[model samples]
Target: MIRLRYATMPSNGGSRTSTGTIQTPPTPMADTSTEPEVQLRMFSQPRFLAAVRALVGTMAQRLGFTEMQCGQISLAVDEALCNVITHGYERRPDGQLWINFWALEGEPTGLKIVIEDLATQVDPDDIQPRDLDDIRPGGLGVHIIREVMDEVNWERRSPKGMRLTMIKRLQPGRNSELKNE
Candidate 1:
């Protein structure tokens, strides 16, 4: 089973809070029929983003994500990558963007994506939804990500960095064998 535990940090002047810890259970000794899952990580770059999009599409399709769902995830991911590249890395172009996608085993049909960057930290409490009435070109990425993903989580890593984790649940009745934790 996978568990998430929220934690508070006192190392950085008590100004930051972590979303949760991700814990995965050890593999079963009896059930050795299934293959191991894979994870992907990349740095901040145009080529990396393109590869991420393709990988998302392929995985979503294989997991039976609807066309709309795939598109929504793609857009949200793009926005997230852009934010990491621009705001997080301060447009350094040479910064790194780490991305990890994994199938949530023994769950109610779900997938999890984790994006981490060693850039300036963004306080989750500081992010506020923009007003719709006020026409503006900026400050819409966070809103869009929240709308598209089933669950969105943000946290600062110790000294310097931020990690964004997003989860999407697939349609019910497709994977009944797995149990939710």
Candidate 2:
């Protein structure tokens, strides 16, 4: 996994403060190897959805899923993120969406994905897939997600927002190093 590093510097050409001393901020170091790799993005806009989809697709492929399966998984993830932007954040571009992807560390040997958003929380019980009998341009996200992933779970965050967890087991006969943690 790649590491993201950032360091803070004095804003005023190294000028001393009122106390006649300069202070340095601590550098930020992230332990990405053992932790679930995380990506923070702004998805409250319709335009950014494709990039999100591409990212998910790439990750899915990297996990040894076939191209076709990657597309399906990516589409499901796209729909879920769209719902987060439209419903959870109410289409407000300022809200942040956090997505994490990791290979499980135990028996299952599959991919694990978790999406989190600091937007309005929705009751998990209130979420349902639209009836297929009625066709429409919208409201099929929940259904698509359930259809593609082996496991789907939604939860309201403790203080605010919501989390969606989706998992897919390794394809039959395929071997992978990823396992449940």
Candidate 2, residues 3-69, lDDT tens digits: the string is: 2212223686663313222222111212235445434345467787777778777767766677888
- What TM-score does each of the candidates earn? 0.71, 0.75
Question: Over the stretch 1-181, how does candidate 1's per-residue lDDT look in tens digits?
Answer: 1122233348766644343344332222111343224344455666566667776776666676777888888878888988888888887866765566666656567677777677899788886667778897887888899998899988886667787888888877664232323
- Residue pairs in clash, model 2: 104-179, 105-179, 105-180, 106-179, 106-180
RMSD for each of the candidates: 13.0, 10.2
lDDT of 1 at 9: 48
| Model 1 misplaced stretches (Cα beyond 4 Å) | 1-36, 174-181
Clashes of 1: 2
